[model samples]
Target: MDSKAEQQLASIANISNQKERTTSYLALLSTLFSSQPPSKDALITLGRHFVTSMSMAMVVGRRVLGSYVIALCAGTSMDTTGTASITLDDEGSGENQQFMQAGINAFKSSEGEEVRRDVVEGVLAGGNLSGWCEEQTTVLRHLYAHLLQLEEDWLGAAKALMQIPLEGGSRLISDEEKLAVYIKIVRLLLECGEWGQAQTYFSRASLLIHVTKDKETNLSYKLSQARLFDFSARFNEAAQKYHEVSFDSAIAEEDRLQMLKAAVTTSILAPAGPQRSRILATLNRDDRVHSSLPPSLSTMLRKMLLEYIVRQEEVKEFEAGLEDHQRATVEGGGTVLERAVREHNVGACGKVYDNISFEALGNILNLDAENAENTARRMIEQCRLRAWIDQPLHLLYFESRSSHDTDAEAQGTAGGLGIENKEKEVEPRLWSERWDDRIRETSIKVEALAEQIQQKGLIPPIPA
Candidate 1:
C-alpha cells in the first residue's frame, strides 16, 4: 500500500456514515490480509501499522474498530466447537525464524490474543506459498518457541494468556473456556483488590450467561460481582444484584437466603433514613424470611445489636432518661425517715427499733459518755450485727432535734439529773450527724449494687 492509498483509507474511515466507516475499515483489512504471496516485510509492516491505527482508534472513540483490529491480529478462531488449533512448521531455516519473530512482535504489540491469533491464522491459512517459505516457517516456529519461553518464565501461561484481549475478535474460544478464563482473572483481580478491573471481567462473564443460557453460572457470577461491590462500599449496586439473584426461581432457597442476608447487611450499613428503611422493609417481606437464622448468624446479629443498642454510651442515655421517672417513684423520693415510718406501720417496726437503739448508739457514741451511754452503745452494736448477719432490713432513721443551745434551753429542763441538760444538748448534734452519715453511706451502697447488676447483665431486685 502506498501513501496515497493509506491516506484514502484514513479518509474513508473518518466518513460520517457509521456503516461506511465500518465497511471501509473491513475492506481495508481484507485487502491487506488477502494480498497473495504476502511479502514478509509487507506483513510485518502491516502488523505495525494496524497496531498503531487501532491504538489511535481506541483513543479517538472508535472502540469497535479498535477491537476489530485487535481481533484480526490475534489468532482467535471463531469455532465454538472448541476444535481450533494452531500448528507451526519447524523447517530449521532463517525464514521460519523471521516469521516467528513477526508473530512474537504482533503478540507484543497488542493486548488482544484473539486478534493476534486471527492475524497469524489468516496469514497461515491464506496458503501464501511464498510466505510459508522454509525461512519464514523457521521464524514462525521461533516465535512460538518464544511464547513457550514466556509461558515458562511466568508462573504459568496464565499471565501470557491474560495479556491477550479476547473480546474484540470474531473467532474466539468457546463460552466455557472464556468463562474459565473470566473466573481466573476475576479471582486474581479480586485477590489484588482491583475491584474495578474485576468488575469488567464480571460484566463480560455476565454477557456469556445471556449467550449460553446458563442461569446458574450467571447467578454465581452475579453473586461474586455483588460481593465485590459490597466490599467496595457500593451497597446499592451490590444489593440490587443480590436481590436479582435471590429472587430468581432457579436459585436455591439457601442461596437466596444467603444473598438476602448480604443485601440486608449492606443495606443496614447504608446511609440512615429512607434508603435503609426501604431495604429493611423489603427484607421483612422476603418470602424466605425465617423465624430464626442459623446459630452463627444469629450470634452475629445479636452482637451487632449489642454494639448498636447496648453500648455503654447508649446505656448512659437510657439511664438518664429513666432518672426522672425514677425520681417520681416512692423508692426515689422517700427519705430514710419516711421509709422507716412506713416499715414500722407495716409491722416491720421491730427491725427499725432494734437497728436504731443498737447500731446507731454503738457507732455514734463514745464509751466516755457514761456507763449508761456505753451500755446503750453495746446493745446497739449487738442489734446491728445480728440484723446484718440475719437478713436485710429497710428501716432507716433521721434525727428530728436541733442542736442549738438556745433551742435546747427553751425546750428542756426535763429529768431530775443535772447532767440531763448536757446529755440532751449533745445528743441532737450526734444524732443529726449520724443520720446524715448513714444516709450517705446507704446511697453509696445502693449505687454500687446497681452498677454490679448492670455489669452482670442482670436486673437488680426492687427494694421491698
Candidate 2:
C-alpha cells in the first residue's frame, strides 16, 4: 500500500475500540492542525478521508471533538475575509460543496451552546469571508444571530446580521432574502434602541417589500416601519402604521392585540391636530377599543377624541403602560407622552372656551403660566392650532377653524372639493366684512343728520 494509505490504517488501528473511532479520528485531525499548517490540498484530502467521522462526531457528545470539527471546517487561522488557508477550493467541485455542507450540517445539528458559540466567534473573529459559498455562510450567520438573540444581546445580533453581503457577494440574493435580512436587522436594532441604524435598514426593506409575495415578510416590514416611526417620534405615522398592521389576519391573535394596543398608545401620543383627531375618531369607534383594549387606553382614546381634558390620574395610568422610548424626554421639555398630553389639553381648552386666561390654562395643564403660554404659542406658530395669544391681556383666543379653511390656503383653488369648500368658507368671512361696511356707512349718515339738525336750530347745542 502507499504511504498515505498505510498512515490512515495505522491511525485507525490506534483507536483501540471501534465504537470510539469517530472521536479518535477527530482527535487525530486536531493533532495535525495543532502542528504545522497543512497545504490546502492536504487539508482537502484529510477532510475527504474523515468527513464521515466529523459528521458523526456530535452524536457522541464530545465537546473537544466538536471544537476540532468546527476548526477543521471553518478554520482556526482565518484571513481578513474569514477564509482559512485550508478552505474548500473555488473550483465548484461536488466534493468541495459536499465537504462544506457536511460541516454546516454537523455544526447545526450539534446542540452544544459552547460549540455553537465557538463556531460564531471563530467566523466573527475574522471578517465574513465572501469566497465561501453564500448559502453556507448565510445559514451560519443566521444561526449565530439566533444564539445572540437567545442571550438577549440584541445589538450583537444585529451586528452579526450586518455581516451578510446581500447585494455584493459570491452569489446573487433574491428580494425576499434581502427583505428578510433587512427586517431582522431593523428589529434587532430597535430592540437595543438603535433608531438611526434601524431606520437605515428599514429604508432598504421598504424597497423590496412590494417585490415579495411573502405574507410574513410583508407583515414584518410594516411592523418594523411602525417601530421606527415610534422611536423617531413620528407618532401620527406610527399610530397609522400600527393600526394597519394590527388588523392583519396573518398575525397571531395575541400579537394582533398587542399591535392594537400600540396603535392606541401612539395615537394618544400624537400631536393634537386634525390628523390625530381623525385617527382618534377611528380608534374610538372601533369595537375592539372597548372590548379587546385595556380600560385605560380605551378611556384615554375616548377623552382625546371627544376633546375632554385629560386628568393627572388618567395620564399616570396611560404612562404606566408606556414603553421606555414612549416616556423618553424630548426636545423643548418633558416625556413624549407628557408633551402630547399638554398639547391635547390646550386643544381641549380651545374646544370648551373661545378664550382663556394663561393662568387658568396653566393650572389645568399642570404647567406654569409662562410655559402654558409658550406651549400655545408654539402650536399656533406651527399652524397646528388655529388660535392667537394676546400678550398684553395674557389670554389665548381660540379660532373656530375647519379643514376646509386651511385646505384652501395650503392647496389653493385647484378644482374639485377645493373650489366648492372655498366658496362655502369664503362666504361667511365675506358676510362679516360686508356687515362692518354697512355699520360704518349707517353711522356716517346718522352723524350728518345730527349736525344738520343742530345747525338748523331744530335741536339745542351745548356751549364750548
Candidate 3:
C-alpha cells in the first residue's frame, strides 16, 4: 500500500466505536478515488486491509457497517482498475478467505443484493479461485450462475456451475445435491447445443442417478440421456429412452405426447436394422401412434414397419421436425435422415425383389446406381439386410427367407453380409460328391435316350 493508504488503514484500525471507524473508512476511500484512482497493487492492498478491519468491526456487533465496508472496497477497486483481483501471500490467505466470506454473508442481507452482486461479479471475474475457501467458492459460483442464467447465457451459466467443486469441498455435498447440479449442468449445456460437453456431465450424473430417490432428478436424468443420444446420432437408443420417459406419470400429458412424438421421429430416423425394425414394430403396435401422434408420423411408421418404400414428400415432412444435429451430414455425403431412408428403402427392396439391376435400384431409391449399390453393400455388410451383390452383373440378389427367419436373422450376430456365419467353422463341399451326383444324372439321361432309340428301332442289333 502507498504511504497515505497505510496511514489511513492504521488510523481507522484504532477507532474505538465500530460505526465511527466505518464511517471514517468509507470517507477516506471516497476521497482517494475522488480524482486520481489508486494503482492496482495499492487498491488490492487497501482491499485486504479493508476486509480485515471491517470483519473485526463486525466482531463487535457492527454487521451493517461491515457489509457496507465490504461493498465499498469491492466497488472502489472495480471502478479504479476495471478489475478487483487481489493476490495474497501464504501468510495473508486467511485475510483473503475472510474477504470472500464477508462478501457472501453481506449478500444474504435484505438490502445488500445489488452491491454484493457487484462484489461477486468482480471477484469471480478476476480473482484467483485458489484463494477462496471451498464453501465460499461454491456459494459465490452458485450466485454468479443464477445471475448468468437470468441473462439467458446458458453456456456461461453451465461453465459457472461446472466450477462448483462437487467433490471434496468443505461443504458436505449430498448425492442428491450432486445429481441435481450435474443434471442442471447437462440441461444448460444441451440448451446451447453443446452435446459433446453435456455428455461428460451426464455420465457423471448417471453414476449417481440410481443412488438417489428424487423423482425430479430421475426424470431430468432420463430426459437428458435421451437428448444426448439423439444428438450423438444413436437414434435407436434415443428413441427407446424417449419412449420410456414419455410414460412417466409426473410429466404432463402435452409433454408426454411431445416425447412420444420424438420417439416416433427418432425411431424412423434410426439406421434401418433389426434393432430399429423391432422398435418400429413396437411403435406401430402401440395404439398411441394412431391416437396420440399426427397422421403423417403414423403413416410413415406403418410404411417403414411393413418394409414399404417411403415417399419423398413423407420424408420432407419428417425432416422439418428434426433437430440440427439430426439434419447434419454424416461421414458419407448426405443428412442422417437421408441415409436412414435410403437404407430402409434398400431393406424394402429385399422384400419385393429376388434380384434387381443396380440402375433400377438406384432409380427406385432416387440415387445413382453406384450410390444405391454402396448403400445396399453397407446394410448387407452390417447384417441388417440379407442380400448379396453380383458385382459382375451389377445386380443385387436378395436372400429370401420367411418373415420369421428374417426377423431372427436381423436379430442374429452382426458377423458378415447376413449370408454366412464367418465366425463358425464350416465343412468344405467335396469335389468327389459333386462328381458322383453329376455322373448319376448323366447315366439316367443316357438310359432314357437308349430306350427312346430302341422304341423307334433306330439302333440295329449291334449288342446281340
> Please, what are the lDDT tens digits per residue for candidate 1 over residues 1-464?
35644575558656876556655654554454443323333443344344334223422223222333332324422222212233222321233333333334444433534344334434333332231122232223223323433334322223333543356543444676577556555655665456677778777777665555565556667777877876566665776677777788887778777777666555434322223333444444454544534443333223222222223343233233221212222332342222222221211222235434324332332212233233333323433111221113323232232444232232222231222232221222344665587699999999999899888979766689
Q: TM-score of predicted model 1?
A: 0.30
Sort order, TM-score high to low: 3, 2, 1
RMSD of each: 27.2, 10.5, 9.8
Give the TM-scores of the predictions, in the order they appear. 0.30, 0.68, 0.69
Which residues of candidate 3, in runs, are more than 4 Å off? 1-119, 129-133, 403-464
- Candidate 2's residue-wise lDDT over 1-464, tens digit each? 13573477357746656456654554555444442233233333343333223233333323323333354345212222221122322322233433344344443433434454654456444542434334445555666777788789999989988987777676667677677788889999999999999999998888878888777777878888899999999988999899999899988999989998999999999988767866776676578989998898898998887778999999998899999989889777799988999999998897689999999999998889999999998887666776767678898978775654443232223332333222222112344664586599999999999999988998876779
By lDDT, highest first, what's the ranking? 3, 2, 1
Query: lDDT values of the candidates?
Result: 0.43, 0.68, 0.70
- Please, what are the lDDT tens digits per residue for candidate 3 over residues 1-464? 36777877788778988658755765664444332222333343454553333245333223322333333343222221111223334433444445444444433445444444444565556544442244444545665666677668899989988887778755567777787788889999999999999999998988888887778777888899999999998999999999999899999999999999999999999988767866776776678889978899999888887789998999999888877878999766889988989999888888788999999999988889998899888877677787767787899878667544544333332332333222211133355764586599999999999999999999887765
For model 2, the stretches where C-alpha displacement exceeds 4 angstroms are 1-111, 128-134, 401-464
Candidate of highest lDDT = 3
* lDDT (C-alpha) at residue 367 in model 3: 86
lDDT of 1 at 3: 61
